[model samples]
Target chain A: MQIRDILSFSMHAATANRGRTLLMLLAMAIGVSSVVVLISLGDSARIYVIDQFSSLGTNLLIVLPGRSETTGGPPPLLGETPRDLTLEDAISLTRARTVRRIAPIIAGSAPVSVHNLEREMLVLGSTSEIFDIRHLDLSQGNFLPPGDPTRAEAICVIGLTGKKELFGNQPAIGRWLRIGDRRFRVIGILASPEVSLGEDLGDMVIIPVAAAQSLFNASSLFRILVEATSPEGMEQTRQSILETIRARHEGEDDITVITQDAILATFDRIFKALTLSVAGIAAISLVVAGIMIMNVMLVAISNRKTEIGLLKALGASKGQIMQLFLTESTILSSIGAAIGLVLALLGIRLAAFLFPQFPLYIAPWSPAIALAVALITGIIFGILPARRAASLEPALSLARR
Target chain B: MIHLQHIERIFLVGDEEVHALSDVSMTASDGEYIAIMGPSGSGKSSLLNIIGLLDRPDNGSYELDGIKVSELDEQQQAEIRRHKIGFVFQFFHLVPRLTAFDNIALPLMLSGIKQEERQVRVTAALAAFGLSNRAGHRPDQLSGGQRQRVAIARATIMQPSVILADEPTGNLDRSSGIEVAEILEELNRQGITLIMVTHDPDLGRRARRQILMVDGRIEHDK
Candidate 1:
């Protein structure tokens, strides 16, 4: 049969049982759309994470005080007594040839009260170089300048959340807030960083490292932030830094080196597996839809037996009869597939709007796969009915009313 | 021309072999109108089916246009049926879903005739059968005579060499049956062989040659 004839025949068949055909198409659409949305969300999450890490400067490396033996756990408390990375280690790493920038961080939790507003917040103390290494954007005044180290300078930069919590619509740049027992002037306000995959890292405060060290009166250091020249040089730079730190600490394997890309890759694998599992579950509905198509086609053949016999008697060969029925079923599935594709696209768009962090990307391969799946479903389910129609005895069928 | 030499058709029903057609032999020349008349189980329909290539005989040599058809494979037989045979049935089995025009165009389509040629021939056939006004009407929309006319139009659309009508007017009234019979005879007059199966003696006697079948055997030939 010609392509036009097949298409028209299929349309007629599908329209003949509109409700059932529509339900089958909806099932197929849900299957395809869910897969697309899940995979897209996973992809978006990875992209968000990579962008977050990249903005932190390619040269930067974070050194937490004590490494946790297990992966993915909360960091050990500062007062719980782990071997704290100190100013001596930071100074030695800074003086090393491979290290371009080194900043010692002293972090603590403190309640900041400005007028009637009070909220507990994480506070980090670091040198001016920390701003460049962490790629912090200043919304207001300047960072702490290099000056006398002995005198405690009460100057700080507040994050967007910290500023909002303390000032509440009031200007926060040049304001004063109490950190622990000491009062500090906010020299600058950090611009709110964009949330990446729903993770907001801009919820803290920064002050001069020396001033914080004296105010806390606790130690030489808490954590050290180091920045290498290039990511490619990371391995060698890490080796040199580790060797130098170990040599200073009398040969100890106490530090861990982790890259953002490796963590992102692990997340990607997990989400991809999740998406496939969800899609597999949804695929069951497609099989059910296929069975429905088969049942309907069989009924159509039975209803049209005399017509088929008439055609056969009027010179339609067995193959031609078979093609006609097969074409009918294929028409049903092709329309279903087309409808499914449109629904999937709409579903992805709706999901993307509902959850900004959840990206729903529909790859071109998805529609191609849907079409192929529909075609195969049509043929596989269509075979039994087509065969039944072809096997009808022309004489007997003609005898039927 | 058509020839059947010593044709025998047997049916196996639950370990009992019933002869649907015994040693039957007949010849039908081009442009001849013939009818086979018989009661129920008399093998009249079975003989027509064999002649129409709708069934194969258990033992026989059947030839159409001097080509031995009984020995041909299923596909070969189907090819001959497609190109050489047409059938009009007792029920006027037009597809309910198709319009009268499309029903008549079906055979032309199966023969792979181009759409333009099919349209021309189908239009002519529809007009010839006085169905031009009902071309777009489905079988249910047409009367019994009109449906029979559509059936005849479909059967002859391909211009096959032989037209087989098995009780073509069985479901129609007397006047409608006469109209259908005249259409078949006109096609036969145009040099196409026409073989019909009927139990009505009046209809049987209208044929130029008549064969009477009884108990799977030809009782008389005239």
Candidate 2:
């Protein structure tokens, strides 16, 4: 028979049994929609994390004082403490060719008293280079001046929150605030930006690294942020920082150098695996839908034996008979897949509306994959019933009432 | 032309083998009007089915128009059946969901004929069968004689050389039955070979040649 003729026959047969066809279509649509929606959820989570990390910084390398081996396990938080990273080590890293600038950090909490008002706040100690490296904007006065690394000038920059609490609309610049029994001049007040990565940028105070070391009575630095001039130099700059720190700490590689790209790559791999696993779990429903197609088709074949027998007597070949039934299933799956894609889009929209923070959207290839899988399962499950119908004896089938 | 030699068919009905056709031999030239008549279980319908290529005889050397059809494969037999033979059944066997026009167009459609030509031929066939006004009605809406006319139109749409009918008017009233019998006779008069299986003696006598089957064998041929 011609393809058009077979298609028409198959379509008429499907429409003749509307209830069964609709039931099969519903099963297939639900299966495909689950796959698309679940995969979309996983993809949205990955994009959200990547966006948050991007907001943190670019071409950044973090140097910590302790070393931990990464051997398919979590990094050891309290691993070997070989040697301390001091101001001298951070100073030596600045001499490397790939390094652009460095911010040696010393973090501690102290109470600030301006006359009768006193408030305890976190104090971050770094150099003037930290202003450019961390993309901080100054709302008033100047940042700490460039000077000798050991000079402990009693000057500081307060965040907008600190300025509001201690000074309370009073001029904060050039005001003397007592920190740990030492007086410091507040030279700059920081402008607050939106909260990113859950760290409030407006609640901290900044001072010179040398002054913080004296105030806290500690010679060791907490962490060093190294900024590479360009992304291409990030790996080279990380190696140079590690070597510079290792040479100063008695030939022991006691620091971990992590680039932003390395963290992003790790997160990318983890999210990709998560997406695949959930999509695989959702594919189980598609298999069940295919089985339902088989069951319905088998019943249809039995019910239409007389029609099949009539066709055979009119000189239809066995292959033609099989093709007619297979065409019916292919049509069903195509319609079901289309409906599923629309439903998945609606589902993603509903989720996004409910939780505005979640970045939910369907991926590009998910619809294509869903459609291909639906077609394959429909054809595979349809084979047994089609073959059974084709194998019927024309004489015997016609003999039946 | 048609020829059959020592055709044998057996059925295993629970542990006992019933011989549906045993050592039956027959031949007829082109355009011959032949009737096969017998009581139930005498294998008249079985013989008609075998002649129509609906069933393969266990043992036979059957030839049609000099082709060894009994040894042909399923597909080749189907090809021959499509172009060389047609069938009229007792139930009319019109696909109930299709309109009368589509019922007449089925055989041509099955043979991969184009829709435009199929349309012209179906229109002509409908007018010839006196069913032009009933073209849009389904089989259930048509009268018994009209349904049989639609079946005959479907059977002859391929313009086959032979028509094998099994009690073509078995379900019709007396007048409708007579009308259906007249149509089959008219097709036979047009030089298409006709082989009919019937139990009615009066109907059997209307044929140019009669074969009486008894106990799975040809008891008489006249």
Among all candidates shown, the one with the greatest TM-score: 2
- Each model's C-alpha lDDT? 0.78, 0.89
- Write candidate 2's Cα lDDT for A1-401 as tens digits: 78998889788887778899899889999999999999888988898889888776678898988877543655548765568889999999999888888899999889988898888888888899888887888899999888786889999898888889899988988889988799999999888644667656677789999999999999999999888989999888988887777778777777888898999999988998999999999999999999999999999999888888888889888988899999888778777888888899999999899998677889988999989988998899999999999999989988876
**How do the predictions measure up, each by TM-score?**
0.87, 0.90
TM-score between candidate 1 and the true structure = 0.87
Residue-level lDDT for B21 in candidate 2 = 97
**Per-residue accuracy of model 1 over B163-212 as CA lDDT, tens digit each:** 99989888899999999999999999998999999988888889999999
DockQ of candidate 2, scored on C-alphas against the true complex (2 decimals)? 0.71
Worst 10 residues of 1 chain B by lDDT: B106-115
Please, what are the lDDT tens digits per residue for candidate 2 over residues B1-222?
999999999999999999999999999999999999999989998998898899999997899999999999999998988889999999888888899998888888888999999999999999999999999999999998999999999999898999999998788998998888898899999999999999888888899999999989999999
**Residue-wise lDDT of candidate 1 within A199-253, one digit each (tens)?**
3446677888877887778665777778887777667777877777777665554
Candidate 2: which stretches are off by over 4 Å?
A: A70-80, A107-123, A128-195, A202-208, A211-216
* CAPRI accuracy category, model 2: medium
